[model samples]
Target: MNFDASLWLIFILIGLATTLPRASFIVLGSRVALPLVLQRALRYAPAAALAAIVAPDVLVAGGQVEILNPKLAAAGVAVATASLWRNPWLPFIAGMGALHAVRYLSGS
Candidate 1:
């Protein structure tokens, strides 16, 4: 492999971008206060991000819409199994098993 100056520059830019916001928070913490509305909205950021990441996978099938997917079904099963069995690992195993079972049965 060869080292490229452009690649290094790109990496440097990415690192700077990632660090600058965090550094800004530390450097300007006392000088600034997050707006109340913004803070409230920020509180939902994780949920929004999780939905953004999982919603598509759990809702989409083929090129069309499918509100009920194997993953979603498996999640339901996982939640139920977890609650009933009270085992953390069982949920994961059951979820995967349910998803695979659906896939196998559906032949998709």
Candidate 2:
């Protein structure tokens, strides 16, 4: 109920909440199995999580939507480069090249 006691309690709860989900597989071992559908869907979790993180940065600028943004075009170029070739570095290089090219041309 006191300030220090409540703070410590909240910290402990937060730590437990964070640790439980990550540690569940190890603690439960093979005894518990996720469903087949869930297992299949989990394969895209990393890509989904990545998109969730990268999307806002790519699509937004100046805290607002700008259709002509260099980053937006760079993202499109990167996606296209990724689709056209299997090399991982091509997309990065293409995206960065497009970004710099647009920035230089637009003088922005």
Candidate 3:
């Protein structure tokens, strides 16, 4: 196939790849069900996903693992805020605030 056709094919494949899995449950209806333990375990999927995304940026600074960094310190503060208050927004606000405060203080 030509370049344009190849791109279109790839795009369609990606669209189907993402769409099919998500639509499967609805398509399959209630006939199929996950195990109880698996269902319960999926509840933490979002948090686990978020951590998987954020942990790298927070832990790695200057392309290396550093014990002290604004991001790391901010993450700590954010975790503390999350544990203290159940409010979801509080942790985000606290984290960003801590990040900026530490960056400013440390002249980073």
lDDT of 3 by residue, 12-104 (tens): 999998899789889999999979998899889889989899989899998998879999999999889999999989999999999999999
Q: Which candidate would rank higher by TM-score, 2 or 3? A: 2
**Residue 6 alpha-carbon offset, candidate 2, angstroms:** 21
lDDT winner, 1 or 3: 3
**Ranking under lDDT, best-scoring first?**
2, 3, 1
Off by over 4 Å in 3: 1-19, 31-48
Query: Against the true structure, candidate 1 has what lDDT?
Result: 0.84
| Tens-place lDDT digits, model 2, residues 29-51 | 99999899998998998899899
Question: lDDT per prediction?
Answer: 0.84, 0.92, 0.91
* Candidate topping lDDT: 2
Per-model TM-score on C-alpha atoms: 0.62, 0.67, 0.65
Runs in model 1 lying further than 4 Å from the true structure:
1-24, 79-88
Give residue 22's lDDT in candidate 2 (0 to 100): 88
Better of 2 and 3 by lDDT: 2
